[model samples]
Target: MHDASCRAGLARHGIMISLKRRIADRFHTSRLARSSVVVLLVMLLCLATWATDRRSLHLQLLTYAGSLGFIANSVPVVLLFFMVLVVSRRVIFTSLIVSALMGAVYRINAIKLETLQQPIAFSDVYFLRQVNASVIHLLSHYLSARIFLFAVVSLVILGGMYFWERPLLNLKRLSRIVSALLLALVAFGLYRGVSPARKLYDRNVLRIAPWAPAASELHAGLLGTLVYQAIESSTALREPVDNAAITRLARLEVPDAGAPSPVASQKPDIIVIQSESYFDPSTLAGIDDTSRLLPVLARARLAGSVGQMRVPTFGGGTLRTEFETLTSVPLAAFPKIEFPYLQIHDKTMPSLVRVLKTQGYLAYAVHPNDANFWNRERTFQSMGFDAFYSRKDFPADAPEDGWAIADSSFTEKMEQLLDRESRPVFIMGISMEGHGPYLENPVLDKAMRDSIPVPSTWPENAAKEYRNYAYHIHHADHELGRLWDYLERRKRPYILVFYGDHLPGFSKVYTAAGGFDDHQPASTQMVPWVMVSNLGLKMPGQPIYSWMTGGTILCSFAGQGNDYYAMIQKAQRHQAERRMASLDRETLEGIESLSRLYLRGEAMPGNVKESARQSFCAATGVTNP
Candidate 1:
């Protein structure tokens, strides 16, 4: 009787398994069932991509209004999925592929917006080719374990779907081949904005907000905006250079163009340090102790030129500020190019390094991070640096404040370079110590971190973030004082320009701390800068843009730079004296034209170019090629 019962149970289990397999087979093989699943999956994916994130759902819905614009936004996404479907003829696998891709894009966009306060541009897609170990390590700080697990599970599900799903159609027959080709052609034409598709993006359907990617994304959808930007950037790049504006600016006389240069016998060693995420903590509310936070900056104010500096970018794009300072060209000049380093194709570009090299200075760049980051390893050489010292150049056991090498050890490396080189060296050192995601920093002892003050009303996370930022910045200040002492003790003349790249990415801390005095977010606020020297240099303190800083330093200490730099210095003086509003449309266009010409190794005007060529030839004894 027991054997009979066991046999019946086994037979029942086999019957249940047969029923499940038949159901699955019916769903997979039936045309109607597969089509319905494909449509449902496509609709869900469209909704997900349109929503992007929970925070922006309301704005996205109201901004686009489930009308023709919604169709315009979703058509491309659907066509993309369909394209995969036609190729693979597998509904589940195609949906999984599209889902994974859109998921990654949305996640990256969300992180960029949170950290940089800027939306992702179509140009940022170029970074995919740049991914390596350093990039992965840097990005790891922003990702959580939950996200990692979700990604792993997603991949496993996608793999299962690919294996289980049957092909919707067989393409071996000639009739089926012809049908697929016709459908693919139609889809491709519509996806590329053919006449019928173009009508969907009319003013009634889509409203473009120029220069505001976030607004445009709302006006259309995320994928729709990306398509729009691609069209706009391609068109913008093709526009002719503004030669008339360039000519007009070139004719303007440079202020103190004939000012006597410092005697060649006493060429100072120029050291410019672009501190990472450094800012005046006093600017934020609930922080009144400026001296404790930045004692060296306070002391430097008495001896050097101290003022606020308007950098080109905030939070993360260090290369933007670095480019502005080195090239003396405002990034506002180029609206289309987001990452200047990636877009810059010209080798042997004109920059501060090139300008100083003409004046008998050996230019070197030192950064205690990946040299390949932001394409710096290649772009630095293009900027005419004699050599670049990257993470590999530093000690393997270098101290790190967090994920970044400590400013203390970084400054020591710069000091060592100065000691080793007898030539007049122009060292551009970029620090990593003050970089963000400031949590769990091993360099800051628990006692010291706990001692750091924060707003009592702030949440635990906000307070901890503020404390971490304060601890890191405090070390930056100490290093500044250390470097200043090193420069002062040197027998030879020296010039040190120290400044912050941008404010820290402490959005939560700022919100919890309360509103700022200026009523503007930290993203748009200026950072502090000071220029000190051993030569008893005294100058009026004045706020300036990052691009103007290099030119001002050249004229104030060394001399007028190349004609291009002289024009920049003249513009700086004009802006300083309020002769013109900062970064006006005409001024931006003019500088853009001029900077383009210079980067291409071409001259501006006949006279300006002649004078510049003569000076450059005389200084370096290198005849024009």
Candidate 2:
């Protein structure tokens, strides 16, 4: 009887195992299961829109009931998922691909925020088509090694999924064709605002701030803000030129100071060095002595017009400063252009290079980074530069400090160019040595780094970052002094303009150590600039904008300028007197309109008719010079 009871119990256990296997098989093959998986992924993607940015998910949802923002955020992901699903015929595989793509974007956004103090802009998307060795090198400097690991892991997981999971859909050829066509129609409809989602996004019903990307991403959702920006960029780039405003700007009186032209006897070789991420650390709160780090700069400042100079961008976007300095056109004028070089496409734009070239001065640009990084190869030509020497142009054996080419090596190249030049040369040398992710720099040894001081109360990361930044700038300073001395010894009169493109992106340092003594936030913080000449050129040490640099250099060396540059000089004087209140709205709009026209390869300021000029002046209630 005991043997029979044991046999019955064993049979019951076998029956239960068979039932569990059947259930598992059904779950794996069921269409409902695949649908459910897709649904869960969509939900998670929506959550990540705010979660990845470390913002309050509850706050984002509370803005509206069941927030249209969530729906807006899901549209692109859903579209992508559907498209991939159609191609892969496997729901799980499609979801993995979609998630990986989105995850990469989120990671990049996070890095940009940390390093640039700004979120990724629509212009950054252009990098997709611009993949090259130079771009990869730049990514290496800015991005982490973990991204490659993530990619590898993702690929391995995807391979497993592809092999383990069978195709979920088996459609006939006609059905597949129909589905693909339908999806194409839907995508086109959404882009053209036929869908309510597109219309709402275009109107920005959530009022996502265009300028403040971080806050906008948090409030509206990252994907939603990105879609909104895409819509806006599409329309903004197509807007008609404001001919009236351009006319007014072109006709504005430009006061001439009647200063003697330094070129009366001979034209000076003008050298403008735009240092990357350059600033004096002593300007920050709780930091006083930068003499050890920037000894040459300290002494040179005493001899030149050295002061804080306002630039358009904060941490990155070096070309914005470059553009303003070259064109004497404030970036504020082109409000829609984030990366001006990529956005503004013209064959020959008005520039200091053109002005110098007109006077028989040979214009050249040298940057030991990718010439194509900021579309410099194209934009430099458009800006009227006769020649541009980029990364490929530099010596393959050039010395490097950290990941960037050393400033010393860059200075040596400039010296070579100067030595080879027979005519007056306008050399715009942009340095890359001081470019950052300062925490990982190992170029400076312990003893050298120890010499650069930070506040004791600062975090280890902040102190290390500050030390790395100081190390780079110290080398830059040495080169600056070397360049100044080299020019002085040449005995040929020369004008030397040195300035920071923007302050170093030391987000960690700023967070721990605070900002300037005046309590200016990071966005408003100014970088130092100095202009000196062997010809006794002198100007007040007041703050000026990067836009003023070109005009100042032009007027100082030539003592005469075109109408646009003369207007810039006048505005610089006003800026000095009024500080932040310099250019009013009308003036700014006029300047912007003129800048746009100039970028379109139109005539410069003086081409307008006398009658129209007088009318514009009279109507605007401004005196004619």
Candidate 3:
């Protein structure tokens, strides 16, 4: 009886195994029938490209690719893959339709490509406006070859997908293994490439270039060479860089300075305003009537110290500029690396805020946007700011836009802060009203269409949109006027250093306005740095200082009597030496060498660091700390 019962159980187990096999086989057959090799190849190519180029293989890349892919080609590869695999046939078509619709919606609302080039936040509506503008401009300009390029690229992707999907899907078993191997090889290659490239171009080639090359250009050449070589060798992706090693290299020791000096009595309330998209349109002669766009700023130039400020970047990356201004550190040193805000949280920064705090000044950083957006809160706090005001602190009546609080509202808030602070304060206010999505604001739109004159360099084709940007500038001017009026009424001595973060990213507008000449090294990166004083300090007539970073401005204004001032003078002088010595090489190379040493926590070579220290002592009329 026991033997018969065991036999029955064994038979049931065999039946279950057969059923499972049948189900799997059917599933595989169906998949094999539908998949195309060409489609799979294209998808693999795209994935490979993204995997190699992006910093990580995380969800962020997927989301970014999904978002961009949907906009560029009306397809959501991830959603499509899931729908095809899991959903019933009846629902598959419906899913695709819905995905396409949603993609279109997102595409319309996203920020324009040109706008995205800047450091501005993304918005869907803003993107739609750009699409409309691009479409219109493309039609007007009628670049058939450009259009052909777009069409051909699209067709190739789609056609490849249609024909190759089956074979690609069928190869999933083998592909998985191949992908893993390739990814590893690619990562390793990247790591190897970065080090040698940094040493070669960053330390060697760029050091020799006659003109300053953009950081992006340098990075591109390095990445391109690596990719080309890797492909030629058919090697698997390599492992990524060791984060621990990189971090260790980045650490440095702070110099020993005894007790810091007392803050200057005449420090006056220091106010630094980073104006959004502020540029001297007058620089682009024969463009729109800049007089009409910025009448107040233009007129003020005549009465005050005014000239071009050579900034480090164009279009976006405002925080980098802020970093330069606050730290008196040159951006040219670490061309490819981002500002240290993300990387160095614990490092002590010898910034103006810290210098002021030592002297009993209440330091604050004010921005209309989210304080956490770029780790601004932590960065400012680390820099020794006593307080930070973000969107949360904004008044109930503040104006609204896609970004943070409007410039007008920000101005009002700043005025209140100016009055309320008990101690002589140092305030850094960042404006946002002049930010992008220039078409949606009623005030700006009206101004562009009617009052504000578009720059002449604006393509006859893209004039309307360019005019809108000008109108935005006009609005910024009005806000400045209000601030100036309030300052004029005050009895307290204060100094305001106002400048634009960078030129806006509308190449057509810049070219039309005559600010950009393709033949000439386009340097719209040059902004207007002006010092406005209620206490009657005289600034230079020609304020053009050779490509000085922003952080040096504070020391420049404080006069040569403070430790901070002396330090800057020293640094600048040392920089001059390096520059002079590197006359045969590229200035960027020397900057990188200095930067590497600084980041590695090594003492700057020779007397560079000490000279700056001594310069500070001399300027401030105080003994060395």
Candidate 4:
């Protein structure tokens, strides 16, 4: 009886063990179970790629890892891996679709390379145009080939994971855990290294723009903070200001009363030409003297005051310069992503046109570009211009370049307007012949090139290109001569101040011509500001190199420096006064500190008056109030 009972117990135990083994094997072999493992692996890989590629993700992971121990890091990674598995397909599809759309949109808008370098804001109407194109492009470009490739690769990875899961799952999990733990330990070490300098970040670090979508906001915010901290903590990076330099700057004399007392008595007809890419190429080093790119300007300089005018920016975005010149406003601490013209279409501006109009002057603006470019038509109206003539309004005979109508033709049109208009016209002509794509224009003659002298700084190799630029300058000069001849006969008091909007971006010629060394900061911001008139209304003093922006020109000319001009001038005066009062070290330190803080978006505690501060905030769209 006992032997029979023992045999039964043994058989039952063996059967139970075999049953458990069979159940485990069946679950592993099933299609549903296999699919789940494949999906999990694919999701993990995708998560890893995202974590490594995105700046925000890397920053967050590093921060969190430093705070937590190895085990803690592993827990989040594992949890995220599983979470991604649930939404993997949706996330991948969304990303692909968005990328495709973006590519398509960029292509359709004929978005130039220069436009892409700057920030893009929501206020830009061009954004809507691009979006429309992007949708169409995505359907044509991304939905088929790109989508299929991604899907196939994903499936292959899933298949591989399914086949290998039973043997490799435990090892894969353990390896990931170990790697995360090590990374956490490393992050903690880095935190310790940077702990001592954390305060510097709080004091001096500049914040990046926060415009990413909600899904990315938290990540971008944290990442930005970390980057700021890292930069602040670096001992190698020197602050822009030092104590000794500030003292010297303060002692510098206030501009002597050389410029004529602002001409308050007479309101002359204003002919403001915001010439396109107007920097004299001859100014660059190594250009041949024979090219004579700016001979006419050189001649004019002798007759009038010609010197460097400091502009706010370089390369593209001419409208910002226009805004500065017209409104007497400084460049915003943080530049707007799009042209302010488009952003503030309906808003009023205190422009030269408006001011002249108040004096009963007929104000007009002429541009050889598309009316829609930068939304200038609406902006001009808002700025109080009585009329705006763009490409659409110009005659069909006007010569076309890649960007706009030729400067020569534009000038001719201006001449016609000057002759026809009954009122004292305040005409603003924007040139386009010298606009980029810097290729030579067939309309330009060799004699035209030879007539304009190249600057001493231009490189010899760049003579031809400089000559091309010179041709436009000579043509402009010839046109100006004609206008002056007319003004001479009419004997009307007219003021024409012409300056380059900004320097050209062509690196090879510009850098060499500007006499900038490889290590020296580029002086592309320095442009020609010439105040020329046929009437001998002499400015009071010798030529002065005042570091002034576009907007200051009109106000300075008008003998009134209210609003933005007063604020900037006052700030400069204060800095000068402080330098004179303080020790050299203290002065330098103060200036440096002011510049640093100003660049970083920090308010200058007590320096700026409340009204000026409000104006600054209003112009820049900063919510100070």
TM-score of every candidate relative to the true structure = 0.86, 0.87, 0.60, 0.56
> Worst 10-residue stretch by lDDT in candidate 2?
616-625
Candidate 1 on 1-625: residue-level lDDT in tens? 9999999999999999999999978877787987788889899878766766323534543444475556666876787787777777787788788878887877777788777777777677656567888888888888889999999998899888877877876556665567667777876565466677566654445786756767777767766767665545543433456888876665544334334346445678899999999988887888777887778888877654577789988788888899999988777766766677877777776788888888788988999988888899999999899899999998899888767889988999999989998888999999998888875445546777678877688899888888888888888889989998898787777878889998887657777868677888777889888877755554434567898877766765645477787666555554545444254566567767777667566656774564343221111111111
List, residue by residue over 184-250, the lDDT tens digit for candidate 2: 8887766555657567785456668876775676656777777777666654544456777766655
Instruction: Give each model's whole-structure lDDT.
Output: 0.74, 0.74, 0.51, 0.50
Candidate structures ordered by lDDT, highest first:
1, 2, 3, 4
- How would you encode candidate 3's per-residue C-alpha lDDT over 1-625 as one tens digit per residue? 9999999999999889998878756755675534453245336534543433232212333333443321222112333443343322222332333333333332322222334342111111222333443234322322246655755765565455544433213445455466546655544544355564334323233222213322322232212322323322221112122333323222312232222233344556778888877886655545534766777777677876555565666665677677776765555554333444654455566466776677567888888776665567788877888889987798776776423356778888888888987677888888876665443333524534565565444456557556656666676777777887787788666767778887765645544555443334344457776666655544433333332433244434343333324433433443344343222223334434444444444554333434334432101222111
Candidate 4 runs further than 4 Å off = 1-266, 288-291, 333-338, 401-403, 439-474, 507-519, 538-625
Estimate, for each residue in 460-547, the C-alpha lDDT of model 4 and write its tens digit: 6455555565566556555565665666676556667777877764534554455543334443346776665534443312221222
What are the C-alpha RMSDs, in order, of all predicted structures?
A: 5.3, 4.9, 13.8, 14.0
Q: Considering TM-score, which of the candidate structures 1 and 4 is the better prediction for this target?
A: 1
lDDT of 4: 0.50
Top TM-score prediction, candidate number: 2
What is candidate 2's local distance difference test score? 0.74
- Distance from true position, residue 458, model 2, in Å? 1.5
